[model samples]
Target: MEKEKIDAAQESSPGITRRGFLQTVGIGTLEIAVVGAVAPAVQAETRQRGNLVPLTLKVNGQRHELHVEPRWTLLYVLREKLELTGTKPGCDRGECGACTVLIDDRPRYSCLTLALEADGHEITTVEGLMHGEQLGPVQEAFVQEDGFQCGFCTPGQVVAAEGLLRHTANPDIGEIRTGMSGNLCRCGAYGHIFKAVQRAAILRK
Candidate 1:
């Protein structure tokens, strides 16, 4: 009888002791916390070891001094840091022209462009297309011609049109189509957009 009682106690007690279960759970929680904390630290260390460079972007005729990460693209810096949300971010990989901006009077993909790469270069966005409250001739032409449906791609299109007009005062349909081909319009307003550019060209002349 005593042997039977002793075996029962041993078996039940050894199966799952409260102290041991608690200890195991505590250890698992600690391990999770330690791993979680260490991962962020590792990421921070890796970023710190990377190059930290200074950048000076001449945007909209204004020079902005910024300290950015090596991977900081121009679109991120422009919209996030400088509060210029006129440039839309459609495809971050530069496949779409929604993030197009003029660098040195030429259209460039801001999302694929690094902020550091635009250093010491003159950059212009849709917001810079106008002088004071007066809309640029192209912008007015777009409004009159109803060049946009959603207006998301309008900024890039207008900026590209401005660049095109700077080079060609009277671009034919083929030239306009070729020049504005980089920008994409989701609303399928390509015809109106082209007509708007033509109207702007005539207004400018």
Candidate 2:
């Protein structure tokens, strides 16, 4: 009986099959656990290597605290984090003014603005221009005068018009055209948009 048991143990020995032996000895489990542990270590390496920068922005008369990446632009932070998508992105190079938002009540291209740079500053977008259920005067004028064609650039134009009206509540046709020139309309609705600005200016006066 002892001799027969010895023969059976030798046949099913741990070193009999190199691959199967490692699996039977729990080496495969250890390898899988090591790999699983290292994966999260690699994922930890992807966490931000830099420090968090805190910023505060006064948007639409409300204060907001935000932590942002150094490379994130104001437009990205606003649209992505704050859910303010009213500001359109056209050129993204500050030439088209499509991403226009009011910075300190002045028309500025949010695409070029760094999230950190807007700290402690007042910012406004088309979303902020409405008071509950009432549209602002500029928006009302844009609708009444048919100021937009495709309406892609209308938000920027409207925000810019609000900025212009801050300094000159009553701008003439030439001034209105000059003020709105920074914003472009591919639909060739320049004449009507200018008229709308003028009409809004008069209404504000």
User: Which candidate should be chosen as best, given lDDT against the real structure?
Assistant: 1
The number of the candidate with the highest TM-score is 1
State the lDDT of candidate 2 residue by residue for 115-188, as single tens digits: 89988888999989897889888999999999999899999999999999998888887788888889998998
Candidate 2 ranges with C-alpha deviation above 4 Å: 1-49
**Distance from true location, Cα of 135 in model 1, Å:** 1.1
- What is the lDDT of every predicted structure here? 0.90, 0.85
Clashes of each: 0, 0
lDDT of 1 at 70: 81
RMSD of each: 18.7, 19.6
lDDT of 2: 0.85
Error of 1 at 176 (Å): 0.4
Residue range 56-102, candidate 1, lDDT tens digits: 88999998887788888999999878978899999788777999899
